[model samples]
Target: MTSNATSSGKTVASAVRDVFERIYGDPLKQLESLITATGLPVYKDPKTGALLWVDVRELRLRFTLSVNKLEKFIEGLRGGKLMYTQCRRCGAKYFPPQVDCPRCKASDVEWREVSTEGELVTWTVINVKPASFSHQGDYVVGIVKMPDGFNITAWIDADPKTLKPGMKMRLVVDRRPGEGYITYWFKPAF
Candidate 1:
């Protein structure tokens, strides 16, 4: 069995699929074999020595996000810039790029590129992840306070042991692996 810690440079989804194939051969054939022998999807756990019931149902999801309101923000990432939304009416800024200003109940927002400079406010290491992210190694999620006063939540590419509160950070735009989409993240500013 291949160790999960080995690096393959494959997407998380692809890696997970490979693991399943290796364990079960053909999933359909395995299901049929199990049913013929046991009459149920239940099987003995190889490591835990417990009875495990495999779920028969499969679910796949793909989302088409509407970026009409934040189109400029998305475009900025492709152009290697980090963008944010600021309410023209209330002078409030948003890092996640909100179209509506809840403070003034206004729709007048100005999309603007934000400074790369920021301060790390807080962060956490995601040791437990959802199914979609299970193939990847642990990641750090951090909240950065940009110079414009808005906070941006994004993955922090750094050694967690070296990170500290109020540490300097800088926003960066890059393609997200597995998803093949441009996104922003933060890194140690030096």
Candidate 2:
């Protein structure tokens, strides 16, 4: 394959992933079908007769992001207002505020209050979750591209059974107890 790039110049894992994809590109569905049809968790190498056991172990991933650099974002959260960073030089905006603006190749950015109203563009429910979020019921993750063109990632507050793309959404900040951090979410616009 053509030379792939990583932010860190080291991408051995990525290269291995590329090799695996070249060998079995997107085996998720086909593998699932085989597992479903055979009723066994077994997969034998196509080229070699070596057998591989599909471990039933499940893994979930939840990440903690620090808002140390984006203190205005946290303030906005406490004020119940969504905020994003806009580059002072080029006017490039970032939803999940990044310190640097790749567009302008500049780190000089300013925080701006964003509109709460937006339309959901797409979403998915995490049926199988990671350990940290396992305690919580299946949550919906969605993206809403505001008028600023910066899409926000947050849990959408609505019944997963009734959610649809292009629904009206309002951004809101939620105080998660125990963890005690300010995070944002989407609520159905009634």
Q: Determine which window of 10 residues in candidate 2 has minimal summed lDDT.
A: 1-10
Winning candidate number (lDDT): 1
Q: Give the lDDT of residue 92 in candidate 2.
A: 78
13-116, model 2: which lDDT tens digit per residue?
34444555555545656667878998877888889989987655645344787768888777887776778888898987787777798997999988888887
- Measured by TM-score, how close is model 2 to the native structure? 0.61
Q: What TM-score does prediction 1 earn?
A: 0.76
lDDT of each: 0.81, 0.73
Q: Which ten residues in a row have the lowest lDDT in candidate 1?
A: 1-10
**Per-residue lDDT of model 1, residues 78-170, tens digit only:** 788988888999999987889999999999999888998899999999998755566668999999988898888999999999999999998
Model 1 regions lying over 4 Å from their true place:
1-30, 38-55, 177-179
